[model samples]
Target: MSLLADNGKTSNCRPAFVCLLLFSLLQLPRPQYNLPFSVLALFLCGVVSLSLGQNDKAQRDRLIACLASLILVTALLQAMLGFVQALGLAPQTYGWVLFTPGASDVMGNFGQRNQLAQFLGWGAVSAAYLYATGRMGRAATGSAVLVLALMMSWTGARLPLAYGLGLALLAWFWHRRVPQDETVARMARVLAWSVLALALIQIFNQQIDSVLQAIGLPIHVQSGSDRLLDAGFGARRRIEWSKAWEVFLQHPWFGVGLGGYAWHSAWLEAYGGWPKVPESWLFTHSHNLIFQLLAETGLVGTLLVVGGLLCCLLPYFRRGEQTVDNLLLISIAMMLLGHSMFEYPLWYLPFLLMLVIICTLSPAKGWTVQLSGRFRQVLGVSAGVLALAYAATGILPYRQLIQNFTPRNENTLQASLDNAKRSLKLSELSRNPLWSWEADLGMVNYLQPDGIMRDLQLELAERVARYQPFPTVLIKLSILRALNGQAEPAKQALTMAIANYPDYTPVFQHELARYREPELKPLQEMASKAVKAGAAQGGATEAGRLAAVMTVAAPATRQPIF
Candidate 1:
């Protein structure tokens, strides 16, 4: 289909545009929170609307065919590599190729193989559709079968292989109901044979290999199954979920706000003894997205998110377009589920953008609108303008971060630190703090002891007065004061610090050791003498009583003043 024709009838445009805007917004270096997901739901709604529209059927079909071909080609290549490895041949690694490891024994690099296997899965779905639809040639069909077998053997990715088999079986069971074209029937036959061959090979090679090992003719090698055991591991997830529930209970309404997960977790750790509370253990999100949403955004926000997903899924499901939609839907579902196991994938702008694109491109229908030539031109210009604006916003902050941190720009670092301090002060005054308070602390450290002594001292005093005293900060303050000849005050501070945190015996000992220096002894003796003289002058008063106590406590070898 021509571009104009595709644009005219396809419901994809509205959702695609919205997704593009959201993607651009997320890519803006600042924190966007839920805007990306919100926009994505709207995009999905557009797709749903378009799918229900009467126009653009031909255009949508053509796009699906093209996407299927792309997926087939990708799968075919991956399968070929797998076959090469199965034959004990080393496949040429391309620099441009993104390789993720699958099974360590079958594919040496696990991460690279895993990525390849995921792509292969996508390919398998696409290829299955192509074969079932009669879009693939005989040669391509045969090649795809061989590749699929190789992929199954080499990668050992059970999910994709299982999915492929299921798709094939479903296709075969419903073959009679499909269109009566000769090409379609022949394609279906090919798919059935391929799936059957792959399943037999897997069963015989894997299941039969163990039995055959007794006879010394092992056909399949087993990779160690530690990962399989770990798959059933639920303890950590349960703990995280429980903790998230507690957080939700604490902040039931409006939740903790955006970017509050780590801080909240830290707070929870401090009070409740959760293991996830160290300086290094910075957890920005809950492992489960739904739980994370509930914790961070609260019940109301979670309802909106659930409602959004339902709204987007409604139209496509109602139309019974499950077969064609399965590939895209499964991909999204797996990715979302996979992220819940370890990561917050949506935080990565590129991944989020790709998700938006895939969700928008899939579903084949929803809100269709025809645009005039002038309007189309205007849309193009608007997209460009938005992209540029987003790029500019992202670049500025990134550039500033680099500029302030570079080794050669020492002056700039100091200036930046000063600005950060000013901003922090203003924030405290306005009661509206920015998220980057650590930036000020970083700047202070960068300036070191000699460069910012007065400022550091002032800041420490302010911090001690305002915030609850922490052991490390108190120790640092004591050392700073002692070095500046505030010995008595330093000792008093150290005493209080030690009393507050008795666990910090080493720090307290170190501080006392500093006061015992030969040079410091003369100063201490002079102070003692002064106290004794004051006691003689004001006998029996409170200050005189303390001075007399000091005089009596002085050691004989120290040579007390008359």
Candidate 2:
């Protein structure tokens, strides 16, 4: 393929612009999962529109090949890392291949296996593309098989591995049934040899455990087993699914609204408590994508999501163009389907991006060519706006990192520290923040001293009081005060929490235990003295004096102070 055709102009930048806009929208909150389809759709629209302006067969081939190669390389690297981790190597900090520990297992480190599966699916497609283009050899095919095997086993992501193996077997069976062209027949033989080599490696490897220990590493254990036991043979997911069905029954047309499932789930849990209801009744997710979509977006929104998927997949399937791109799209769709059986795959960014890339490569129908001069101008403006937005969002994490890492001794560090602390605090207040309040509270205790931490605790208590109906926040505030050695305040906060949530006996017991610690004696003595003084001045009633005395005296009878 030629780099550029004679008539094809390089000046048309609409495709790049559209991609930028779509990327920005994907970064938005609540409906973040829809970003991939949005990005892919916008990009494809650009590509199709651009293709209308000129004809350049070589350039088109080159562009497709380049994109295919990029996708292949990314997949290869991710697979390699997954394999290395599976072999019991700790994830490398500085390497071409990167793996992060997830969920106390290889799969957990990556947050979800769907992304890795999508990557492998794309890699398989890339390999298939090479074979279709008569570029794959026996050696290349063998290497690809080995890599795929490693990815599947090491990552502990069952879905992608299963899908890839199934597809390969189906392809082998189909190729055997149909009389293949000599070239395709040759490629198939090479693929067969590669599979044979992978089998040999597996045979020699013995136990997966022996291999890990031989390399001075311990075996990776997944939390899924424990979660399964806790959930009663996947009954937790079944419960969530049942609730989603009820939601669908209630709002069969338009969903309650985007991000509304968590709110609705409280009622569901109140009625059907199969899974042990969490102290704080928060919906992790619908756990089923289709159900989640139905519950969140309703029927009309579900249709849009379904339509987007069809628009992304139908083109390549109809054309019978089993190019690397088409394979990626199919694999991603399958992977999503698999992941949706257990997890809400759209929550993560990388998986979402994989979906977009796959959809972008899929063929579309009835793509009208309405590229007028004015429309082109709008495209340029939109692209510029998107570019700026992407830049801003990309920089936020870095800014936060800098603020978080600033030295405490520096004059300006206090302000930065305050900001970081406030960010954590605000996230706690929002209730639906990205992280758990326990985690945020831990950060505050670890980073700040006792005096400043006490002030923050007081502020948090006040904030929780304002949102009095929400007992979880109040419980957390009480815990924070208890940890900071503020017995009186902690008791007051716990009293409020117990009143709001009388059924939460464990929380009350936990706070009472903290009051009985010996380390709290100094504070208790001070509180007791203040109470007696107030009583003498007739400032405190008999009940108030008794409450104050109980707060101070209870710990003295339990344990000796250090």
Candidate 3:
């Protein structure tokens, strides 16, 4: 239990060093969207590690308890928020919670159901930790479990349920095999409670909904759980995973070069003749974490990251005993990692932070650095200051950019244009470079002029498409190209757009129909052909064939402009 013992060491260099190397990977990309998060993680690890190294066993336990409590409280608050949202007691807004509109989604502040479910699972685990360790009372633990179950059910995500059941079964088997490990028994019980809670919710979810409706409360329409057994439930993820695999194959070495999944997905669909995703759905990630890392960072990045984790965990492995603390922490870490296998949970900063903290806290004993008490104090203060500075310089500017670009009633056309320009300027100093492309795209939309300005808009659209490759941008770029009398390239862009969204031909035709320009006729003809092909073939096959033919006929240069 004594993290530092009488060794009087004030630092653990191995973890801090490994953590620094691991987080530094976040800065490998030009955009560095996760740079601010990386810095914050470093600061947190340094402070926590230093604090533990200076404490005795009792003090260390208290500090760890406090940290665990903080995580549990945050997760509990999110669960409560989700519960309220499920009951229609709060306004779901962009500034606060953004539940998917008209769906039975309850994401709290995480903005996605699966992510929220994983976070709530962390809460449930934390509650079990507190209860098994005699920190939380039985009643409080039960209430937390019940609330988490209801919220998890409302999210309508089934993967977490499966994860819970799987973990529970593993815990039971471990306990049975060991027979002497109290930690395994306690963990098994905790997982059993979670599994039971979720299973009960699934069984009675309809009754709960009916009761709420009968009580005159307006509940949002629920997505049926029957979809969990549907054959096509994960079809989208399969499509995205296939696209990500193709991207990895093409890049191989450094992969697509960080945060480039969307860009490459667009490029592949446009040029590689891949199957088109459903309209209105954009795959920002490959859904699976391993595939995403392979597509975005490739072999080198994945090895560095995976190797760093192994290095950090080596001490625990070498210890060879499953202590209660180790089991608890490993269970929590495994929940996140297991979820990563199915979905990109760690992409969000909070989940990433949790993983970092768990890693930092896991190693019981390691190479220690002895420092004077005064020196340790100075180090802690320096880390705090550095963390504050990084947040101010990086996160603040990013926040401002979001606010500026986010539409409000006062944001007129000119105001919106000015905000986009300002956002572009801010991106230079901000840690996030992705927003720069977004700002440029906004300018392309807000700028309304003729002649050279129109040409500038086309150029901007082309530039954004290289990085973002969003369907709308491709369509707009095609229209602009046609207006500029570049009919062939225009058709190529339209073909790529249609290829990415083959089933959306009617919508594409409608957009083209809105334009009175004679130059748009060919683009309309292409969309109409795709629609006819889709109708004749009855799905993706015929439409995909047409898109392939069109792509070959007007093949745009394969070289990426970015």
Candidate 4:
């Protein structure tokens, strides 16, 4: 079947405009998981609306197939790049494929190891769908499989690797729901063989590791573990989900405010005894999707989301016509739901975009529920205004930083300060305290004090601590107190910093401990200066003295600084 026919049946401006508005709400926050994602969402919103149109199931299905094909192609390419990098046969830094910080694992484009894994898993499913339905050739399918196995295993992303055994089961189950019994059989064999081939390596996992190591492609030790369930990736995630649940229980109806999880995490850990994860690890979302919605939007929103899913998915279970598109969508939907239990798949906009498309598509036309004509018009106009505002307000500060970026230290500092001030103004206009917090931090890091550096640091530290007493902020406050001659307050601040992040105290101690040796004389001298500046009785003083006296101190050595 052909895609995008010559005859124009409808103007999709209304739906497209409404989508733009829907996406604009996703922005309006700093350090956004990646602002470019928002742009992509907007473009996709327009394309999906204009191209797919309302009630055109065939076009929608074809589009989904084409997108799956694209995903397959991308997976093949990423696998190739990652394999080359892992083998040390090619440069790793080329393009967006950068080695993760501190770890040798390479991720393409996403910059995160886990995200790359999820994207690759999506690719794997996409390729599997293409081949199972006969849209993709055998040679292409085999090549895709080879690359996926190598890359997935090499990156050692826990979810994809450990969940290896589950993929085939998913494939068999989803394919059976379709009307074509032949396709179901084909899919079962294909998926079972593919999954089996990947799983076979486990029999000689050690030998495989040895071979890869010899060739410098050793699987990453951190993520490659076959350990099924991390008890939710250690206590950190356990505590995060725990707090979110407690918060949800209290506000079972409305839950906490949207975008209120982080603050509540801090509050719960502080007061509710919800088991904080060594203040070094801060949580943003609830980590679990259901619990997240429960804490943020309450049961009302959660039920609405659940109802929508039921609307989209219940049809598959009932006996009816089913196509390859329906099969792929259901598989992806299931994968996303399962992955969301351990990790948030929808937080990434690309995955989220795919999800929105798949979940919205049905044998029937239009969305599960349609907005009224007047509401659509109003939404369109409102969306346009909000989109423009979001783009202008958020991008302007970063634009200044980007455009004025200079190699010269003085120029860079001034440019940064300018952007900080600009961002501060935007914060005032938008009433988002995060912007102001960002501006103050920027000023502290870059601009000349002009005389109020102390005030700025103190106020910034106080303001930030009030919301979330992140160890970094506390450390800064401690430093400022020491420099300002408030020695007792400095010690108190330093104590709070260390006590708050017990896990990180060793790292902090290492930084101070470096000053003990003569080789670290510069740091030693600096510490001495800080101590002489009236921080004489604080942890800084003891650390400096110990660092100066101790000839061989390990960075991980812990002392009673806190």
What is the lDDT for 541 in model 1? 47
Instruction: Write the residue-wise lDDT of candidate 3 on 281-340 in tens digits.
Output: 456787888788788777776776777667655544443445545555666677788888
- Better structure of 1 and 4 per TM-score: 4
**What's the residue-level lDDT of 202 in candidate 1?**
55
Off by over 4 Å in 4: 1-55, 88-95, 161-166, 174-180, 213-223, 227-233, 250-252, 274-279, 363-441, 444-470, 474-500, 503-562
C-alpha lDDT (0 to 100) for residue 175 of candidate 1? 45
- Candidate 2: the clashing residue pairs are 1-58, 2-58, 101-109, 102-108, 102-109, 103-108, 253-299, 255-298
Model 2 Cα lDDT, one tens digit per residue, 1-562 = 3212233223342332344344334323333222333343444344343433232335545655666577677777776556555644645545443445462245423544655655565565556556656666656755775676555444444454345454556446435544444544554454454445434433333364566677976655332112323433454566677778778889897666555666456444433333332233345466788888788667766666666666656665553464433443464466666676677766665565455545544455333344454554455456557756666764754444445433243449776777567556444433523222333333333333234556765665544343132445555555556567666666554544432233343433443344655544443444445345434545344343333333322222211110
**CA lDDT scores, all candidates in order:** 0.47, 0.50, 0.66, 0.56
**Window of ten residues with lowest summed lDDT in model 2:** 553-562
TM-score of each: 0.51, 0.59, 0.78, 0.67
Q: In candidate 3, which residue ranges exceed 4 Å CA deviation? A: 1-11, 19-60, 92-97, 173-187, 212-225, 271-277, 311-320, 364-437, 447-450, 454-459, 480-489, 501-521, 528-562
Residue-wise lDDT of candidate 4 within 131-166, one digit each (tens)? Answer: 767888878777777667656665656666545666
> How does model 1 score by TM-score?
0.51
lDDT of 1 by residue, 1-562 (tens): 4432223322334343443334333333323342333343333333332232322457656766786687677667666555444434433455323233342234423234444455554565566567667676667766776566546544654444454455565455434444454444555566566566556655555564466556864235431221335443444455456667778888886566555565455334333333321122235576667777778767765665555444444434443444543434444345444544444655444344434445544453445456443444444455556656656765744444444432233458786676656444433322212213333332323322223565565464434322223454444555556556678755544433433333343433443444644434533443345345434757434345334333312222311110
lDDT of model 1, residue 287:
64
